[model samples]
Target: MPCLPHELIAWKILVRLPTKSLLQLRCVCKAWRDIISGADPSFSQAHLDHLHQQVKKPYSLLIAPRIKSESDMEDPRDTRRPWADMKVTSPGLYLWEESQKDIATLLFDISSFPAEGAATRHGLTHCDGLVFLPAEDTVRVLNPATRQIRVLPWSLNSVAPRRCPQGEGHQAFGFGRDHRSNAYKVARFFHRETRGMGGLGMEVFTIGKDQCWRETAVQPPYPFVAGLTATFFKGSLIWTIDYYSPMYDYSHLDDAANMPCFVRFNLEDESFSVMTGPPWYKGPTILTPTLPR
Candidate 1:
């Protein structure tokens, strides 16, 4: 029997396997290991391209189920807070497929990197098959297919005032890739005090490079809606504009100026731009990706 050529094995056959399987097969031989995990990125890029072309339907759902900590179970005070039961021993991600409606498989767990205080489960942000899970003050980036995880540095807002009115001091986070540098970044928008004045500030952290969060000179035009995820598209993270608040100056506008808008932050330039929202649109709006025709 004749064996296939090196090019056929690397590009044609290996590129079609799932990430998890490829990672495991890396140990089978030196050639396979180099092709699967090496300094050169051509093979990996080809694999990603193949995966994208093969995906026709969105059947995968990343789920992080909330589990109560042992301390919460011992306390019979009956806490009514929603996140009271969010902390647990080992939080995990479950993948639900449309074909297997009743069965959800556990992909990985994050018990190794627990939050400092009570852990709050947030929605998972998916970018190029990577999952970004942001907790209270820590963020975890996970590759569900390979079960590899990275816990980012702690993000703190030290300059924020100790107390503020409700809905005034809000913090929102975003995760996206910078196309120019081909690096992934995590962005945080929070309330900060500068020169005895209150305003919204932003800080960014580059994964696999930055040791700490670097504060960006440019600030957000408007505060972000709390508990809403930012949409990543075309090298930018976009969020629905929150209503004008006293924290930032709004004296330049009248009552009619208050309306729904979009604040786009370019990951490459680290700048913000205000885009007008749909006219006569009412209620909440979530930014989502549309299939290209």
Candidate 2:
């Protein structure tokens, strides 16, 4: 294998390459391929740990315009969409540094995204540098820096049990890394009509490998509020629901609303568990996970 310039030989420099370029580099030679692939679990972990010890700083923000179907631009298919300002459309993906500096650089067009007939109204979820853009009927996983994309299988909600009259449920999405296998995963949840309004449907997609969605077990105790965002933290996806809402029929059980709980789905194990929420939490409230100092 030919030697790379001393500067380019470093793993740190190579890891910074955009997704496409890094992949292209793999074709350069056997040596380059090994270096790129080696950075996966072992090298990547050490590098990130070193960075955490340094002074903390604000990172870039993932910005996309509000979910507006008519306003989504699928035509001009440019990465940066330099002429985007001309059309009264929406804001494309860009990075914002401290003091609101615009980096109109990365081209992350999910249209023709993970599927053919482009999905619309992207709901973005970010974790460990992978951004999940959930569209109408499809879900796209992307590394904006790497320029890599993964599209998930279509939702089987249409054919799943209790298709008609969806039984007053909400859709939630969680994206995070499964430390056990060192792979990224996406977890989606929603409610299906069943006895006692306790049945919840869950489907999981492992990025880059799984081609289809696999259903899992869920017996929810609260009524899910539709359109509420799901958060990913510590390998678990958490969703907030209304425990006392009229939407939940409580005749068969005790006061369902009296105990508000968090429906947590662990990505690696692919299991659902319920835990007692904060004592202050009485009704539905927005919840997100964060690292402690």
Candidate 3:
């Protein structure tokens, strides 16, 4: 009987082992299987967060090269060498470089690039070792360490294109890790016609049970005056907006008075507010927030 209790204790420790070791322990016994896969939300979330933090490392962001000349082909394969040649050394930023294989590969560190399965050629945003890819209507969340990808189903308003056809309107995305809930949140925004200048609207989506997505109510008082950039920060998706006057034509920017203003999104409250830039900074700038370790 004493031996049985000791064996049980050993199994308990085994189940909580790292992912690779846990996979091996799954074959030890049926009891081990049940214990390891039990529906303990807290335990599961802790394990996931542990795994995510363990592999968090600096990543490079690679952009697809634009074809500027007649010889430039739409096929990424045609200009692979140049894409592969481009690299960025910034820490905590995920970089994607075009590869000879015609796919954008994410290069971490200075070594090899991990091959990501059939990925859409879209813009990528990185946070806490997770890469958010906005591909048309779908957003994919990928873990570069494990090479696992999950597609998030989100409803995007089609009216955005029709309304802002000339200026490419605004699309903002925020990604963050929620320590309290042990879940990750991805939020996107599409501007709508509202009572404000030139009329603007906002929409939000959050991850729900079963790894699904749920749309939230439209947030009023859009964040930006002109352009939008969404990023994950401080356990919430943050939208950074640049302000502009409704009557001011962009062409008149040469006159210093036509400068852009700023706004921000508070994910927790689903609210909007003005964002003041750093005191010493001037001109157009992009801000990306770092998640707390």
Candidate 4:
């Protein structure tokens, strides 16, 4: 059989396949693997672009469930009980595809990624086929398609959750690719309190490149409420402003004060900007209008 040109194989035929299939095809030979696994930046971007264009659902929904061990004696979430101290045993990541709307396919198990103590919260973030799993101190970058896991360096700024549930400090995370540098980056907002001193700051870490978390010159305009995942869109990470309180205090506020506002951090320039929230009618509605006078 006449051998196909590299362009025809890589660009035309290979780019058409989904990421999972492409990863598996890597074992076919070293040459094909290089093309599929991002040896060529253009090919990598082209494949991602192809996936976005062809699949209505460009990204997979990664579900990281906090499964409590059977031996857990108390519920950490119980307000009445003392800090349960029950460890969060996440059962690894599950992938939900558009084709399988009703079922979520398990990709990797907990044993695949090991960690000490509680490793994850309830949320997961995805961008360009990569899943970002943020833990207490370390952030893991997982390619569900390839089942490749890259654990990043522990951040000194990350404040470990306290024995009491409320002691969990304020922190939010986002992950995305910087088009200019062609590198994946993780951004975070944190307010660490110790010795009666609290400080708000932002940090960025470029995967496979940065040895440590670099504090960004741009700080978050508003404090981001913890437990809320930042959305990565168009080369930026955006988070809703926690106007009411920085310590996850959601109570004692009227409806008008509860409306959400956003702050955006650009990956390329490492700049922060405010984004307006959706238009909401703030005027009170008259229960019954006088019949047109």
Candidate 5:
């Protein structure tokens, strides 16, 4: 009976620790490993919830392209190789903490990239605690706090053509959670045709599942701004559809294609719905809607 009580106490104490610590503890023993295995359905949600709570104290910002100024000081996100002769620029992250403003706020050490051994680019889409990085031919998802990284398989969007008819073969990626399946998914929208960009195709890749890119039956009503990234909210992926209205600009639309709005693709049904956009904005517009994490 004494042994049973002590074992129960240890388990209880273990669950309450930070998930990173729990992951390291898994290697301690078989019994401890099973306590936090991914096979256990409840483990993931509890771990994510705990992480969500912990990161809130010091809010994390998901930045893209470049967030820091260039200076003579040593920078970890230098795009050039160690022995390179020319200059290259890579995406870098800056963290904001209320109490720690005096110290430098970069996430990784000054000499390391986000993924230690990989090519670095300047595009990232963020959802939940993970930031999804897109390179020329690959996609990587990183959990900033836990130091976890996942590289996705090649998909339709990965191999984009050199030139596109509509707007230079633009592709946008979305990452989000599906509550119904309790799975995280990466969504890609791009033109599949080599010569034409008439309409975009949608493909989904579920994390931890050995599934190929599953094509969706639906496509966006208006052409997507090839450069814009998708925003995640309420189990849906949102993006600003870039199209000029006939009433305002005669080049992009007629009576047939009047206007398009901010659009959302529901992760569950693999379908899209047009949402209200800005009443007035001259340049390319993106709807900024806030959803609780």
Candidate 6:
């Protein structure tokens, strides 16, 4: 009998294999590679949706070693350990061992977060095979299995804004993907000084393109907020403002709230909106992407 069609065979094999196997099999052939790479949105979305439904309960969690600051290291008797654990229900963190430099592709296993004799110097945030490190202004995108790190070009000065003489404030950085463009983007939210003073300015940098940053038209009304936390979902950037109102004055009382609200910036239309959260949920945290079950 003749061999089964490549797509058919691939689909059959993919259904039985784990997420890691499917990721690795993407490198097996050109056709298989394209399919798994999400070049075809419909199929990719379907596969992602199926996987989401299959693992609705809980699979694994990503754990990273906590960073030790100079203030926390004053005690001479303190000892350092190699591993850290964090409970995660979604597939977010990716691991790439430094030792396996050349062939380091992204690992999907939480257990693989701290493999035998692996260094835990850098924490990882995964999007595709890309690993983002926020402790510094730089990002490292690598495939641990292939040990290939595509260091995209960026300006050091652009990322670190100049300090205002009056000590006004600084901006916050967030990284996420734009599904419509199928590109990864880094967004910066700057604080404005006053009304008509350009309340909030957003600069977005897309991956695989020349070093170019585009600014958005929407601006936040309040200028008192100190920090911004952003995440990408459904082709837009969602930002969370974390602010502490000074007791000195109540000028910003109109904008003050106990919980942060979701501020969305649509990449396709370049628009902004204030989004309300679930009725039962409370507190502020980075919004992570979740595949629907």
**TM-score for all models, in order of appearance:** 0.79, 0.67, 0.56, 0.77, 0.71, 0.56
Q: Write the per-residue lDDT of candidate 4 for residues 1-293, one digit (tens) a residue.
A: 99998778998999888777887899988899889877787898888778668635534467777755655545556565333355556677787877787888887775535533442452567787678887666678888677678888878877667632236545778888898987899988887573211356889999878999999976666676565667777888777666545334434434642243677789999998875454562422211111110
Pitting candidate 3 against candidate 5, the one with the higher lDDT is 5
- Model 3, residue 118: displacement in angstroms? 16
lDDT of 6 by residue, 1-293 (tens): 99778778656656555566777888778987777665665555456556657644333332343433433346647555432322212222343455544443435332323222112122344554355543223444544433455554453333232342123234555566666665677665554443234444666677666475567566543222333335556676666543332212333435333344566777666677776445654544344323221
Residue range with the least summed lDDT across 10 consecutive positions in model 1: 160-169
RMSD in angstroms, candidate 6? 9.0
- Identify the superior model by TM-score, candidate 1 or candidate 4: 1
The lDDT of each candidate is 0.69, 0.58, 0.48, 0.69, 0.61, 0.49
lDDT of 5 by residue, 38-129 (tens): 55656657666666676456644543433232342276666664422223344455565667665546553222343221222324667666
Candidate no. 2 TM-score = 0.67
Which window of 10 residues has the lowest lDDT sum in candidate 4? 284-293
Q: Which stretches of candidate 5 lie over 4 Å from their true place?
A: 4-11, 50-56, 62-94, 104-122, 156-161, 166-169, 194-198, 244-258, 281-293
Candidate 2 lDDT (Cα, whole model)? 0.58
After superposition on all CA atoms, how large is the RMSD of candidate 3? 8.7
Model 6 segments beyond 4 Å from truth?
23-46, 68-131, 141-152, 155-169, 177-184, 191-196, 208-211, 220-228, 231-236, 242-262, 275-293
Best by TM-score: 1
Looking at candidate 1, what is the lDDT of residue 269?
Answer: 94
Sort the predicted structures by TM-score, highest score first: 1, 4, 5, 2, 6, 3
Off by over 4 Å in 1: 1-8, 75-90, 111-122, 155-170, 195-198, 255-260, 282-293
Candidate 2 structure quality by residue, lDDT tens digits, 1-293: 99566336645576555446766777777767766654345555544455556576676676764332344456546456443232222344666766656554435654442222222233477876667776445567776655666677777653332242343233556678887887788776665544346555677777767777777664444555444446777777776665444447545545434554567678777876766556665544445434321
Better of 2 and 3 by lDDT: 2
